[model samples]
Target: MNGGGSCSLGSVLCVITGASRGLGKSLAWELCSRVMPGSTLLLVARTEKALQVLAEELTLKYPGITATWVAADLGTGDGVRRTVQAAHEMNGQDTAQRVIIVNNAGSLGDINKYFVDFTDPQEVDKYFSFNVSSALCLTSSLLKVFQGRPGLQRLVVNVTSLAALQPFKSWTLYCAGKAAREMMFRVLAEEEKDLRVLSYSPGPLDNDMQEEVRTHTKDPDIRQQFLIMKESGKLIDCHVSARKMLDVIQADTYNSGDHVDFYD
Candidate 1:
């Protein structure tokens, strides 16, 4: 685990999308304890109730760290604006020397439909708006706000998937979106030499999303695969994957923008 369990990410302004549940929620838990006292946690997600609960719990547990929650759908332009504005609000904390933007807001996107059903442009656009476009815009804007300080460090993490590299029969939109976001972060890493970027595939997490895949995926083979993973207790725990991601960040060994899978 390296020093992930003990090391500090310094006083950080950490922004995590999809912070309401699953891996994002777990990441918030792990990061809140690891960052320095004055660190700020800006948690963003579509559900205000969930975000509020998470924010309150974290702040109450870690009184020294400020936890701010912004409830917005990252798919819309206004949602991205609201989130970036919140980041700007937190930027006054000059004590924060590191900024970690975890871009984890994305959807499964019609797992019941195969590629042949993906004929509607609006449907495709909607999927990309949330999965690909929003991430690119949010990450870029946040990076600018967190950038320019000579000593400040920035890490952008894309919660990507095996579908980004491999094809799933019923997950046409999802696979395309993941691939697009992964490439986007890779390009960003190349353009900004100082920033750290990672595309982490957390494996088949035993969560709601996995349950959806198991029950609704159009392809019987793929659906059966997910079912087998769940039944056999082979799916990775969200917290386990989250901790490993933090460990990887603390280790800082992987080349920037590289894709690191849970198994890897």
Candidate 2:
């Protein structure tokens, strides 16, 4: 509580990306339920309709909560600018609320081709843009808001995956992007004294991304591995996974630059 006010739900401003569906949607709901009165939520996603739907739903569910959304693509520079602008506008400068940025939006880039054999440079760039560059841009943008506000706590939670720590065939782009994001945060944590950054791996969850892994893979073994997780009832529901992740965020046991898995 360096900001003189207690770290209550009301004093926290949450910025969540990739919040249209899947774990992003689930995490939005969880935060809605937990945030205190006067808390504001800024959700970023590509689908305008979905963001509007969520905004309407949250308004109805929690009448007192303030929620806003930016319908822009995180994979592009312009979209990233629009998202940061919207967040900055919604998150007033005068407010002493601690800022929480959750970089949750990501893509499982081209799974059909081997990384070495994949020659489409455009596709490679896109994968990196979605998974790594976008997160970096958004995080850097928000850091501007806290430049002079040392009293306010700045927390960044970058949703990562097991692929960041291990290699997989045909998953070179995805794995490398995740690793880059984690390392970026590790460096950010070391550089900032008042900021707390977490590179959190949510583990295997029953989400659209996992479904893509099961169906979109060219490798039979990779497909079968995800299939086994699904068939064995081992895939965690997005809501449950989100709750566990929140537990880690709330517990705040790890140091500022640490990487944590859901299982850990």
Candidate 3:
């Protein structure tokens, strides 16, 4: 309002991991419209180029919206620290009325292998490091930075899947990771009464991960089902799912620890 430029000092602080593409990317766009002028979005991903491009796009398209990108592997402790530090130092933090942390960074794991084939301890631990541990540590650290402010609304969303509830033939790692991550947030919701926690299962999305399932899934039946979904054009669009999630947040009626699926 002072300089006459399009940008404004945003007050909403949103941090999204795995934000380079898919649902995370769509969330960035969807959230931009919902927040008032001067809202900030911190995008986290391992690809620097993708993050940079996204940040520029968000900033350019949405007036008064500030989009920042952090390219780092959230699997490591150092990466978690760097991201938390960046969030703590982000400008206009004092003005923020709301904080959103979306723990969406995850992997399908080695889908080509069956359960018995996954024998190595290091391999299992590595899979869990990124898909499971990263979300836990990163969310806890950011909470410490943004906590203790009265009237400051804090929301944490864990991107989960049906695999958490049901077993898939060759997706042991992915299933276990989703289940563990969902449970973690459920526990958080119980421990932190002020925080709103959501375990959202976006369903089978029409994205790169679905493509991987169609091609690399070791279970013949599961692969065939995914292939059918692709062939029949049944996979859910990322934007559509993102919108549903945004609607859920705005509605704010569900129990904090409940698992809400796209169909639900």
Q: Residues 56-174, candidate 1, lDDT per residue (tens digit)?
A: 99989988999998989898999999999999998887877888999987799999998888899998999899999999999989988887688888899999999999999999999
Give per-residue CA lDDT, model 2, range 1-264, as digits (tens).
Answer: 111123234466888999999889999888777666677888899998998899889989988678899999888999999987897787664464567899999988888778677788897888888788889888998888545474677799999889888988878888899889999999999898688898888889887898899998877888899899999999988887787777776777789978788788
TM-score of 2: 0.93
Off by over 4 Å in 2: 1-10, 148-150
Candidate 1 lDDT score at position 237: 90
Clash pairs (backbone) in predicted model 3: 9-38, 10-38, 10-39
> How many steric overlaps are in each model, in order?
0, 0, 3
Q: Each model's TM-score?
A: 0.98, 0.93, 0.95
Error of 3 at 243 (Å): 0.7
Error of 2 at 201 (Å): 0.8
Of the two candidates 1 and 2, the one with more favorable lDDT, higher being better, is 1
Q: What shift in Å separates residue 203 of candidate 2 from its native position after superposition?
A: 1.3
- Give the winner by lDDT: 1
Off by over 4 Å in 1: none
Summing lDDT over every window of 10 consecutive residues in candidate 3, give the lowest-scoring window: 1-10
Candidate 1 clashes: the total is: 0
Better of 2 and 3 by lDDT: 3
